[model samples]
Target chain A: GAGVSQSPRYKVAKRGQDVALRCDPISGHVSLFWYQQALGQGPEFLTYFQNEAQLDKSGLPSDRFFAERPEGSVSTLKIQRTQQEDSAVYLCASSSQAFSYNEQFFGPGTRLTVL
Target chain B: TQLLEQSPQFLSIQEGENLTVYCNSSSVFSSLQWYRQEPGEGPVLLVTVVTGGEVKKLKRLTFQFGDARKDSSLHITAAQPGDTGLYLCAGGRSGGYNKLIFGAGTRLAVHP
Candidate 1:
């Protein structure tokens, strides 16, 4: 319960369809991150948010991927015109501080499947 | 791009045996962390080594960071079935965004 929580544990989207995944970080966490993990591969950074501001999004694959933490507490990752290559486990993690290398707590993640 | 490489992609050992996994890289890192991930679950951080040549122990698990900060290792003494999982090593740079670069991971299977 105190850990990060992700909505829609499983998602299936057809080609060219749009999908949105939501994440609720632990209460009062200042830093939140989104990662993409393909089968048999390690989790790769997607984007990071410090409060309401998105400081880095270099890991996002393409323009079709967008993430926002409007209120700084809850964030959403939206993928438009999804492709089969986009299928992966989307994970959300949160840490206490923005600068230090604090331990991150991850959620169960949303398994996205693009057909 | 800074890359972390883990060796012995897969290891299957009988219970009570000892095994070691390694993570190597060319670029120095500010900190290195080890995590264990089970099926259908997120990874759980086991330890973080910040200082170069640092060695940390968590129960039967031991972690070492290279003096150059470019590599690290994880050793399990007397592995057990519960220790079976995907072991990952991640590196954090000193400046700019402290984004973590993860290794490919070593899948360990401890059979009883």
Candidate 2:
């Protein structure tokens, strides 16, 4: 069985540039989550999706962050006018069910550096 | 805001030694989960403790949930070098689509 996968293992961008990170959740997974992890820190929740519907976006830090899962299986996180503070590893995780009680499978994550 | 605090931010020990990592919070949670993450990789789920005072074991690792469901601990017996990684604790609330609140994490280094 395949686990969650994120693309562009590493990315470097100018401070004002926009960047998009993609995530492919495990097949048949109904719940997907996005988290941002700073260096030497724990991952912070960004958003969550149940199928194609975005259920939670309160964790997103600011209006610059946007995420969508239109097809219900794949998701993309876009950051506009990236800031130096936005530098961190973007992690994607998915679970078989929509409940948090279910164990989540995580992807390697995309490390983004804003200079 | 629900916040999880992990103690002993960093640990270094020789192989075969025993170690424990703690996660604490003032807020009660519906469930708590432990994860181990290696460099250049995402975290892998280790165990989930749902009941108050519940304990679960996985080989050399033992996980315990606090009686009030506000804390958790992970103990490793005779740890090996392979056990080295960043240990993270996450708490799940009763509602809100199962969003998780995570701790800063403890980085463990086990030298063989």
Error of 1 at A93 (Å): 0.5
Please give, for residues B1-112, the per-residue lDDT of candidate 2 as tens digits: 4399998899999999999999999999999999999999999999999999999999999999999999999999998999999999999988646688899999999998
Tell me the alpha-carbon RMSD of every candidate.
Answer: 1.1, 1.1
The whole-model C-alpha lDDT of candidate 2 against the native structure comes to 0.94
Model 2 docking grade: medium
Residue B53, model 2, lDDT: 100
Worst 10 residues of 1 chain A by lDDT: A96-105
lDDT of 2 at B19: 95
Model 2 misses residue A7 by how many Å? Answer: 0.8
Label model 1 with its docking quality class.
medium
User: For model 2, what is the error of residue B26's alpha carbon versus the real structure, in angstroms, after optimal superposition?
Assistant: 0.4
Q: Weakest 10 consecutive residues, lDDT, candidate 1 chain B?
A: B92-101
